[model samples]
Target chain A: MAEKTLSEVNERIRDGSVRVVTAEEMPSIVDELGPAGAVREVDVVTTGTFGAMCSSGLFLNLGHSDPPIKIGRAWLNKVEAYGGVAAVDLFLGATQPSIDRGIEYGGAHVMEDLVSGKAIEVEAEGVGTDCYPQLGLETTLRLEDFNQATMVNPRNAYQRYNAATNSSQRTIHTYMGTLLPRMGNVHYSGAGVLNPISNDPSFQYIGMGVRIFLAGSQGYIIGSGTQHNPQAGFATLMVTGDLKQMDRRFLRAATFTRYGSSLYLGIGVPIPILNERLALSTAVRDRDIEVPVVDYGVPRRDRPSMAKVNYEQLKSGMVRIGRQEVATSSLSSLLMAREVAATLKGSIEKGEFVLTQPVAPLSLAGSARPMKQTKEFPYVEDVMSREVVSVTEDISVAEAAQAIIKSKFDHLPVVNSAGVLCGIITTWDISKAVADGTISQVSQIMTRNVFSTTPDQPIELAARTLDTHSISALPVVDQDGRVIGMLSSNHLSRLFAGRRPR
Target chain B: MKLLLRVAPGIVRKPLIASVILETGALVNIERASIDAVSGEIVLDVSQEKCRQVKDALERLGVDVILLEIPVIRDDSECVHCGACVAICPTGTFHFEDWRVVGEPGRCVQCGACVTACPHRALRLVLK
Candidate 1:
């Protein structure tokens, strides 16, 4: 049976008789020796992943100031930290961008700087109270200045994630990295066979209180992470560790162009080979795992999966998607993952780290649920102006100008004789026409390319349309292609204002 | 040596690269080119001795010649040979050899893709 327990493994580790191998080496060792023989020979198989995790942060307790201010608002290195917790405790989310540097510098950078032993600028404001009289604070402090700085990541080390590609005309900057236009490139995350959860798919060995290597520090899995969907193979883990013990090599800050900030962290989990099942599980290879190739161009809740590819194909640096060979990139660093795994293995073999069985197994029943829309008016039809004032294309510039002046609308939709939207003209266009007396007909000055929306579309889509085109309004049309209403930015602003409670 | 030539809209239609080769007897190996009727940019490889002659010849035709000399600088101390820059480099500048990243700095066209994609901040773009 070749069975062992956590305590047995720890005893072997302490006695300098433990055998530890990295996930990369375990599969080959399993091939040389079957699962039963492998279990007898191997004590632990270490797995690791280094990728951008946005849902990671630091919980810091800055000891009370001399005046004893309760920080209502706080900033670390110009990046905002959540001050909604206790009086002195603050949570700095990795993805929160700096007020001045935007995505270039953020909470992730602050965390890295802290790990690098650099000084951080702190600014806080507090509401004055009898016991805590200080109203504002401005000071500089290092990572050691805080009473406690703990790394409490919410969701990390996804079991498996989809590869991303773009089918649109332009490049999209996503958390997956820059997906080139027309499937020019593919970006996939996850450390494949080297991922901890991937090695233990059913959560048999990984659960609450499982010890792990988080950013080069000893960490523990607190519970199933947020959006942990084991059914879909996208399981996640929530972990916590001491920030001061973390190494900068395993912690970094990254910025996706057009997207926001994220923390690049390394996590390693050592699986004690307790039995044949655990031994066989650690032998999973890159070719054994498959993930969907999601199209980032399709902006929706459920994006379309263009194809399925194994990690081997992704690691080969190219994958075929609909007859096109796309160059593939990995958002997670495999080299770093290997380094982390090797480091963990060395730590275990050196008897510096020991294994512990989880007190409670993680729950794999719940599925990830999309946020339900609860707004009173979610569609463009609910907020659009019903009485739209439009002019036919044949109308003179003077007549269109008169209608716009009388209606006091900045934009006027120009329609064909059959009442189909043909063009649009703004007050600025009319003023340009008036300045240059050559324009007589509305068609001469009216912009032929008009951006419009549909009545059945969601208000967010309409808002996106207006925002993407840099326009203040969109003519909402029906299924028959007739302008039924106008959705102006003013209407959207008013809708938001009306929805807000006074 | 690698060079990035920005041909003006007015001179994009001219056979500039052909002219430079014909005039100086230098070989121009174009690495990448995106040319249209309006304007064009070309990345080409040439010998070190011939690079100065080519640049002078192109500059005489009002073409903007930028000598791409070590455009992307790799900090060996920070780089872990992650290969994160390998798949995104349009010119295949960084590649894996024995499971470690190797950089061919001459092939890079200064796109800055690898610079941004690098997780360790090990690569930087120093345009000279």
Candidate 2:
């Protein structure tokens, strides 16, 4: 019997304490020899999902070696348990609900490592990856267990020498999977593409101190930072570039190697009371660290006590770090440049970057195109008279009544010769005049001493006036009391409705 | 940290062998893909080394399993567009492409998503 038959019989004996039957035996059992032709019924599948309640509060200025972000005991657990750069895979089940979460902003340069036609490639050995976007900056990265070893970029043909044949040949092909999270800003992309259709006109310019959030299910982030080469089994570290300019400032460069690579990771947040920020970089290698490089380095990177690498000195010539210049010979100056770049992009990364280039300040979205609103109060002007018609004091009852009927005007303004408005003749006034008949003119029946406003008066105040008087119109005039235009109840409603973009 | 893939008990492990039970009264329901419900009996097949591993893994993940002793049929053709194979496979591992079918073993819950996705009786899930 097949090995499968043996296992099936073992389970059968365990479950029913009966003799094992073979495929041939299934015939007699099904044809009436055994209990066979029976109805089978099953139920729906209940998929299981586990949820996590993660909380963390990190406070520190990352560059400061003197201090680090304040992570309380309770919050520390979050960093150790719930936090850390992680890869997320979402399986869209047949039935799922909508979710929106904040973005997970990360360092720039991610696209350089992505599978774009733009990624630069070269050939190397032992398999490693490095990127120094800027020229004279020094930066380091600390990562925990990645999905793979080495940082091989697929563009480089992976050729390992065959010892037996003594010749080099390609080994494997690479594939990319979803190893990083994705977010859509609607206005700016990591690639720095600005789409102008999604902004508010009132504040066409994105202002500073804007608290940015992303779209997705809670805990899902958008800033992308992971890349994997399945063909070579290597995962590349990605960085962020100005989504508008496509430039990276904070991180100068990165290097990935096999074996128990270098380690030292920290998060920084600023603190006002302490007048200092903190940095906590963990290390994988037991290397000696100097407390300060002030004598050799100054300016922005100068700190009384810092755990930093001197790229300028190192790059000037191979510096000796315990008889081993080779160990750290390849350090680049990009890290230092990255620090400067980060400072410049603080506003951009925070979504505070001005969309327009200047002169004609533009918005990231096109909704903010400039337009003009009426400046005159009795804005409702009669084309024939070249005169204002509103709700204040101006034309006589006979003239106003005649104007209303002739112009088919729903609103007539009362104003002074200086063009300032006093009151308005509305539909109600006309109704009363027609009802009283004894008036014979508009002033005799028109409502007087009604709500009026000046040119500088806020439109919101005009709305309140209409609401308070329970009136449908208000006449706007100048300081000289000259009739301007009529603020209609319908127009005010339309403005408020148009304020929100669909 | 080590991640031990745990299989569930109520889920099916042997979607490949469901074809052997074609004449049975029970029909493989496509929508009920997550759960493994057998009409009369469950059938399955796996290499000796992977048998217990696959079974235990599926069990830990909370998937159901059925044992069978039937052979599999592999005909690059004649596998009519049968939904039978898709119904049998709990894991939607098999994707119908323009040229032919592609199987991602790593993604295969081994529960058989494609088994039930098929419409014809071209495939089988034997115990061999």
Candidate 3:
């Protein structure tokens, strides 16, 4: 049981005599040399994960304007940034969408633009004070214009995350990405074997003030991330780094379709091989780690888990859910994760970065709890019939009529060539077509201006829309205008009666 | 070169793809076909040099032809080659080559699946 401390590893790194390997490479090395041999040979194992972390943001100290008043509100490139901290300081949240452009552009984009050396539009309003009388200021500011730009992410790396799938009849857009219907695809985040927190699951070396890599910049672990549920194996990290020193290649602003905006940044951490136990932990492989496959179609906080799958199956590009084989995609970039780990390893080998002992160990006691709700008002998704049957616009009127009859539904939503919502055909429309002796295509008689509702909309709103339009049902659509389900008045009445429709 | 051919209801039953291969001597790889009584849409791949000939041939058969030109555009500045597109593409149009995502535009059928799957918002599908 060979043992070494962080100071010993730092000493080796300083002398350019440290042996470093990536988390991906550590598994093979441990198998060849065994845990004891690996402890003797390897000084550090670098781990990395590059993924969408919506809870990440930046703390910027905008240099004081002339006669600056106490800032009450701030907007960076039309995306709102919180200015409650101080007179010249603001916190730019990555998930904040633009007030005008919405999710198409956001705080994440502003942060990326600033880091890319693009001038950002900064607008602030302040109430006039006795000492500082400036009311409002609108100016363009670059990353260099700020006195200090630091990334203080409340949640960064997750030890492991469940893969997402959709069991509902229609595709659902979520933070996990677009989940195809009936388990058509599995979307998973986290770098698995290359994950920093996963490699150091017990948080032995990772704690407060641990030196690490953050988006190609040197950073430190501040504390445990919010919702740090260690017992469920969902450990997270809160980190801080010099945002001005980060590389644009490792930092990106992203929009997840109907979900909202998120930030994708690279993070890597070095684990010192203190002993055989530490070496064994670093050598954990993708096959050894198992995560649940959660069905996001439920649209609930505690979505049902369909199955338990490992990273190996997920990375292999497909996973089995019941009797069907579903394709899998990773929202986290393993390629970029690999690059982060390699870069960190090179930095340590070149004596540019050194390991540091944690100032305080992360607490392992706290768990996440759901927010309490006063009333349970159902959304369109809760009452809508997910098993929707649709027909293509090119289908003949006779075929559309047959499909509507067979499905026992009066309305049949017509989709275009790309499966986007185009029109809706009703039994009455089909009957009129037959009586006219022009029973050609569904496009002839189908309602082109059909009203629709989203899954997240309140059931009351959906009911109002239906009543306003004088329609029996409203097709539930995604952001891309694709039909996912049907929300009929009958379903709402059933819900009101305390009975859920199948 | 990939193409999306929209055949009118009058010519929907005809073997226009066979005629294109026979007349222009171009190799046509039919990737996907959705046809009904009203209209038909076929996605096919052909050589770059023979693309013009194939389009002209299909047009002569009363088929509306569109030469698919990068249906899914990956913004190099925004894309980090994360492999989300590679895994979600049903046709396997995108693959990892040397740690970077390489797209085979000829294989893309304009499903727009990758556009939604891309977390970076780097990929966009443009269908004119």
Candidate 4:
């Protein structure tokens, strides 16, 4: 009987066949060719899967797939962009490429700015429970940066929560990753000028990625996950099925894959291939009854630590119900798998490969040419903060008025010798005092022990504070009672009116 | 099916990233064709310099490092006195004694080399 491989199934793929072929010696493809193709042969070898995921870095096995990107061009692009065309506009009055892209992809989607050659990343913080595990990550895919040694970045990254052996009572974290956008690139050293893609200065290249985890055991299989890259959508696929209780060594795997751009027919290194369905089904059925560990490539000793325990024994133990419940729950498993599949399909449709999009266009999409949106937002610093001014009791009204004008504010903090933000003196305060002819040293007319809000209080709350106090300006203070910025009543008006401050 | 625990090897590769940090090693193209045989022995062929990296990784996991080398030799002079084998000896085991990068089977693991290096077709690996 012939053994069935993933590629064999790919041959029978009816629209959704994800190709899993061992493509070593796949021709070194160089997108920006000069002399020697900027890449070499790409090889995909398997090591026994599973790392204990020690400290700092997350580890995993990407059984047999890899991402392709040349390194030299990536390096060159990074260097060239340093003070290139974009730098001039960024310094002068040119609308940057990123500004245009920001408008195109909208604040919700982050594309790469060709001028900068870096993708903007969005942190997925408070989405939901299901969205927590696979926090969204995203970047632009510059296929043109392909290298000769077709780079194969295995889909291997997991957080430190892969519970394995004692996972039932204690979780063995089989997968974990602490960082996102782990990049890989290939630098070709070939001296010959070959393809006419780009100049030779582009010697280095770049590719970006994220982390994921998959697990099975305890009578539950998880092909279910909830995450999607916002711009270039993506989703995880898992398989759960019951195997016949036979007594032979076997293999069972449910593969979820994405078919890449046009694939070459010829295989790598001596080209050998083979597959079959019924034979595979039989092979899967006759496996020994030992439970399989969900491999997420965590480092050794750190992964889900396994202990010797038979499924039959677990069933006998009075943990939950009898052996009947231990078998399987058709409805729950089916519903989870369906939901996961639906998410995957939706992501593919929406291009949410990593779940979130950048607030700007800072990726390799090259759409970052000088334009309106790519320019740094003139109002971001202001929106993220308040403009503040301060004054002192010893200063005369004339001095306070001068301080407000010098600080480019209508108000200044009126502090005493203690430097405490006692009261706020705005242009109006000084003007009124001056007009009433009762104005002396600022202390004589200044308000006392006036209330102030923390810098982080929402604009709406600050507005409410101003309206309640009938004040035109509110002093923004820090925890130590230090005045940081001024939340002018005018600023609140702008916010409430939905005006993006210039 | 009987479950087997295959520890994924930890491969660390350093790049020129502000004093490169240790990362998963370079991924070799693992062919699924290895399953086509009943032979369970793992074959690793890399430069002697790289062999240390692989050896160190496996040894950390407590794997007994059993290496194979040529187990036979004729007259040390019949060594073809040629340097073909020297070019490929990962361990740099071959060196010039008398204008000859001659190799002795005693220093050789079962890895057949002097056998193939003999352009005169005098050498052959005596596989045990």
Residue-level lDDT of model 1, residues A435-495, one tens digit each, is 9999888989988878888877778878987887789988887777788788889888887
Residue-level lDDT of model 3, residues A1-502, one tens digit each, is 7888888999999999999999999999999999999999999999998888899999999888898767889999999999899788999999999999899899898988988999998899997888768999999889999999999999889889999999977777788887778788898888889998888788888899999899989999999999998888899999999989998888899988887898998999999999988899999999988999999977657889999999999988779988888888777788899999999999999999988889888887657889888898888888888888899988899898789977646899988877688889888899899999966988788898888889998898788778866899888999999899998889988888999766
Which predicted model would earn the best DockQ?
A: 3
TM-score of decoy 1: 0.84
Q: Say what the interface RMSD of candidate 4 is.
A: 28.3
- Order by TM-score, highest first: 1, 3, 4, 2
Report lDDT (Cα) of residue B40, candidate 3: 83
lDDT of 2 by residue, A1-502 (tens): 1112223323433454323221112223333522212001100000001000011111111131112222111111011111122111111111111121101111111221121123212111111113212212112312211122112111111011000000112111001000111110000000000000011112222122211111000011111112222222211111111212222221111111110111111111110010000000110011211111111111111213212333233223223322323211111112222222233224333333222111232222222123355663222221112234443343455666667776434777665555455456766677776676776555566555766665555566567667866877666665666655556676665565663211
* Fraction of true A-B contacts recovered by candidate 4: 0.00
In angstroms, the error of model 4 at A16 is 75
Give TM per candidate: 0.84, 0.19, 0.80, 0.20
What count of clashes does model 3 give?
0
Clashes of each: 0, 116, 0, 105
- Listed models, DockQ each: 0.35, 0.01, 0.47, 0.01
List lDDT for all candidates, in order.
Answer: 0.88, 0.27, 0.87, 0.29
What is the lDDT, from 0 to 100, of the residue B23 in candidate 3? 99
Model 4's DockQ? 0.01
Docking class of 1: acceptable
B1-128 in candidate 1: lDDT tens per residue?
99989889999989999999999999889877889989998888999999999999999999998988887899876675556677778889987775578888878877788777775568887653
When candidate 3 is compared with the true two-chain complex, its DockQ is 0.47
lDDT of 4 at A279: 16
